[model samples]
Target: MSAGNIRLYSYWRSSAAYRVRIALNLKGLPFETMPVHLLQDGGQQHTPEFNDLNPQELVPVLMHGNRILRQSMSIIEYLDETWPTPPLMPATARERQRVRAIAQMIACDIHPLNNLRVLQFMDKTWNVPQAERDTWTRHWIKVGLDAVEDTLCDNPSTGDFCDGEQPTLADCCLVPQVFNAERFGVDMAPYRTIRRIVQNCLAMDEFKAARPENQPDAPAPGGN
Candidate 1:
């Protein structure tokens, strides 16, 4: 297969988009970024063009040649399968499941509750106050991170990264969730293991480059 043309539809502050960015950076694949301002003009994601691209009207849509891939985890897995030099899934079947489980613990269980659209709906439709909305965000993040901490703490497979010493699907899912936690002022002290993993991943160039504030469209690091 040819090394295909790649394009990424992304929003600067989107954790899901950030996850795909990290995966792309780690794979050392160059791709064009097409910004879809999730909050501008009543969310450009809801526009007819973007909606046609993804009926869900979500960010981080990966266009691999003719294939349009949605869902951050699925996109990353596609990248891993298509270009398998540094594998994201472990060689062992059970260990790969462990990594995927840890990843899904955040992607499926946690992120859906606190996503941009969900929070926006809470604020606009339900009239939730800013403080209450923050509470709502932090509450889910804490719950998810707590479970992640337990998983990492108990699982012997965990190393400096989520699985073994090298970063994997687990770490790709994790760094973005931690970013969301810090954004909402979720106390990191309670999840020491999770914080340690976040710190280790942040030290890497790939994670740093993929951070929300690192994007061209993002506000300065401390601005938000």
Candidate 2:
């Protein structure tokens, strides 16, 4: 599909959506943003219009020409395959597996536990308090990040980025998770490698542009 026809339906603070944004920016692809506010109007994602687009009702849906794509990881992989310059996946199979492992550890294991819906469910279904919910969020993030830190630390493949000097799919996943962890009050003092890599990633123009605060739908600094 042509660059002009690329459109992304994204939420400002959704880590999954953030992952796709990072990948698109890193690939230097120009895409239109269709903001879907997760908290407004009881979530625009729950509307019939959006439900038809994605039964899962998640953001970071990509419309490339007439094709519809959901799931941030899948969309990012599609972008990598469709636009190969500055490839996101590594060249070797083993290296690719390592990247995917790290990506999935965050995307599948860490992120899902603390996703908005899951947190909302905990609040509504179980009447979980905000402080308790935050504690819950922090616990899982620490658990997952602890494993990630172990994986990244002392690994030869770990460079300035997660797997190599150049940012890969793993970096796209890591940066957003770190953002969420920080937002939820997870302590970062223990994860030196993650902090180092995240600092390296955020210093880049692409990663900076894709940050949650930079998104059009993001709330103003002092505004709710």
Candidate 3:
């Protein structure tokens, strides 16, 4: 682990890991990726070896030499601090707070109800049918995105990104959530602001390269 060397434990389709990939690419930091197959062999995240890295049994665990970081939001903040040339937070504290709030709307409120384990629990415990599980995921994502669309569309502060003219931590959180929403068949026609912002993000090489489908460990065509 030399200087600037980072190892990220990631799953190709993980929205959290996708966020970190954008942060790393935006900061112009290069890192090695270790694919953690979430569905293979009964979930590698639950294994003892991986558990040593993150007791929470989650992906997007970052290793920088002796130091280990967890949580996509925390890791992105650390990256922004360590590599500040391309600042992720806005200059003013108030703007930064707004940016963080938008980011958390997706990360905390929308995502928790739709994560793999939650869906799995619904299936394994309550015997929820696949169609109903999809409905559950779509409901949360739509509700969350509706609020986010309102905030961004109604606010004067929003620029090409979530806050100001520059890309911030909020954009990093946003694109991935949008991707997940589309995958689950949530209609995007109503979210004009989000669609515009995501279009701007996808135009940049940093964001394009961070897409889940572009990851090395992503499933091949036809879902492998």
Candidate 4:
């Protein structure tokens, strides 16, 4: 697909959607933003129009010409392969596997448990209280982060980014997960490497430009 033909369906606070935004910006690709309000009127994503685009009813859906794509990781891989400007993965298979491993540790293992739908299910089905819910979020996030921190720290390839110096797919996944963790009151003091890495990402204009607070659909400061 061409540059201007890209469109992203995103929610301001959705970390999965946020991941795609960062990837798009890093690739220097210009795209239109189609906001999918996740909290307004019981979520616009649940509507038939949005559901038609993605039967999964998820955000971060990409419309490239007539080809519709779902899933944040898959969409990002597509962008990297198609664009291939600032590469998101290394040339070597070993490094690519490592980057993907780190990304999946967050996307599959950690993030899925703390998604909005999962939290909603816990509340409506099990009647989980708010305080208990916060605890639930903290517990899972902390557990997953512990694994991520270990993965990054033990590896010799870790640098300013997740791999060497260039921002890879792993870094794209990390920054958003860190943001979501902070929102849910997961402290950063325990993970110095993660905090340092995220600081490096935030310093870059592309990552900063993709932040949730800067999104068009983002609420006013402190306004849900």
By lDDT, the best candidate is: 2
Quick one: ranking by TM-score, best first? 2, 4, 3, 1
Please provide TM-scores, in order, for all candidate models, with all chains considered together.
0.96, 0.98, 0.98, 0.98
Could you tell me which 10 consecutive residues in candidate 3 have the lowest summed lDDT?
A: 1-10
Q: Write the per-residue lDDT of candidate 2 for residues 105-141, one digit (tens) a residue.
A: 9999999999889999999999999999999999999
**Per-residue error at 139 for model 3, in Å?**
0.4
Off by over 4 Å in 1: 220-224
Per-residue lDDT of 53 in model 4: 99
* lDDT string, candidate 1, 10-64, tens digits: 9988989999999998888888889998877988999999998999999889998
Candidate 4 — worst ten consecutive residues by lDDT sum? 1-10
| Separate clash counts for every candidate | 0, 0, 0, 0
TM-score of candidate 2 relative to the true fold: 0.98
lDDT string, candidate 3, 119-170, tens digits: 9899999999999999999999999999999999978899989997889999
**Model 2 worst lDDT run, 10 consecutive residues:** 1-10
Q: Candidate 4 at residue 145, lDDT?
A: 93
Q: Give the alpha-carbon lDDT of every model.
A: 0.89, 0.93, 0.93, 0.93
Which has the better TM-score: candidate 1, or candidate 3?
Answer: 3
Candidate 2, residue 199: the lDDT equals 98
* Colliding residue pairs in candidate 3: none
Candidate 2's C-alpha lDDT? 0.93
RMSD of each: 1.4, 0.8, 1.3, 0.9
